[model samples]
Target: MTISQLIRPAHSFRLTPVVKVASFHIGRASAFRATKTIENGAVNEAVVLPPKDKVAGSYHWDFERLLSLSLIPLTIASVVNGAHPITDLFLGVILPFHCHLGFDAMITDYYPSRRSPVLNK
Candidate 1:
C-alpha cells in the first residue's frame, strides 16, 4: 500500500477547553472562546504509533525525528539565517516563555487544590 493509503484520512478533532487554554498560554496570548479546527491530510498515523507489547525503553530517543518533523528550520530561515548567535539567543528566550506558559496552564487545570491555601487556625 502507498503511504497515503496506509494512513488514516484527515479527520476533525476539537481540543477540550483545558487544552485550548494551555495552547493559548503557550502562545502568550489571551485565550479565545472560538472553536479551533486543525485540518492536515498529510499526516501519517503509522509514524506516531508505538509498537505493541514493547517496553518504553525499547525505543530510542528520536531527537532527529522530532527536529525534522518540526517547523523550526523554516522559522529559522525566515527570522534568523546569517547570525547563529542571535538565533540561539532568541530561541533560548522563547523556549522558557513557552515552557512556563504551558506549565502554568497545566497546573491550573490539574492542580486546583495546590493553588488554594489551607488556613490552619
Candidate 2:
C-alpha cells in the first residue's frame, strides 16, 4: 500500500525499525566523539608553540579561531535551510576581495618603495 510496506514486502531481511533507529543513534554518538577528539588534538598542537612577545602591541590573529567561528554559523544555516545564494556570494566573492584590498593598502602604507619618487625625494 505505502512505499515502506511495498519496499519491505512482509518478508525482506531489513532490521526491525527499532533496531535501525538505535543503530543510527549509536552511529551519530560515535561521530560526535570522533569530532571532539580531533578538535582537542588541534587545540593541543596550537598550544605547543613557544610564547612570543606581542607584535605591534597586540596579539596575532589566530586564523584557526576565525575559521572555526565562521564555520559554525555557516554550518547551522546550511543545515537548517540549504545554502543561501546571497550569503555564499558575499563570503566567497566579496569578503576575500575586501580582505585582499585592505591588506594591500596596509602593506603599501607600511612598506613604501624606494623606487617611488615620493619616497626617493
Candidate 3:
C-alpha cells in the first residue's frame, strides 16, 4: 500500500447509505410539489418552497436576511441596556443562537462537509 493510503483512516462505511437515505427523504418531502404534464403536452404549475429572503423584495436569500435584520435590534437593545436583567436574559438566549446560525452558514459556504466524499482524519 502507498504511504498516504496507509496513514489515512478508513472512510466510514455508513456515510454512503446515510446520504442515500437522506436524499430519499428529501425527494419524498418534495413529491407533492412535483410537476405534471397534461395529455396535450403542456406542463401544469407546481407548488414550490418559498425563498428565504422574503423581506428584501428579492425572491431569494431568506436566511441571511433573517439573521441580519433580527440581530440588529437584539444587538442594539443589548448595548443600550448594558447587561440589565431583562436584556441580559433575552440576549443570553438569542445571541448565541444567532451567532451559531451565522457561523454555520459561513462554514457551509466555505468548506461544505457534504461536498467532501471522505471525512477528515
Which candidate number would show the highest TM-score if scored against the true structure? 3
Candidate closest to the true structure, highest lDDT: 3
lDDT of 3 by residue, 1-121 (tens): 8897667566633445543444344546576785653234336856565877646644325655775677778779878867788777767876787777677666766765545424311
Candidate 1 lDDT, tens digit per residue, 30-115? 55556443333455644466677655644422532343334366456547566577556666665665566556556655655424
RMSD of each: 28.9, 21.1, 17.8
Candidate 2: the clashing residue pairs are none
* Model 3 alpha-carbon drift over 4 Å, by segment: 1-64, 113-121
Q: How many backbone overlaps does candidate 2 show?
A: 0
Question: For each candidate, what is the lDDT?
Answer: 0.51, 0.56, 0.63
Could you give me the TM-score of model 2 versus the true structure?
0.27
Q: What is candidate 2's lDDT per residue for 22-59, written digit by digit as tens? A: 43445455566543121235445755665776664233
Model 2 lDDT vs. the true structure?
0.56
The better candidate by lDDT, 1 or 2, is 2
Listed per model in order, the count of residue pairs whose N, CA or C atoms clash below 3 Å is 0, 0, 3
Pairs with steric clashes in candidate 3: 52-62, 53-61, 53-62
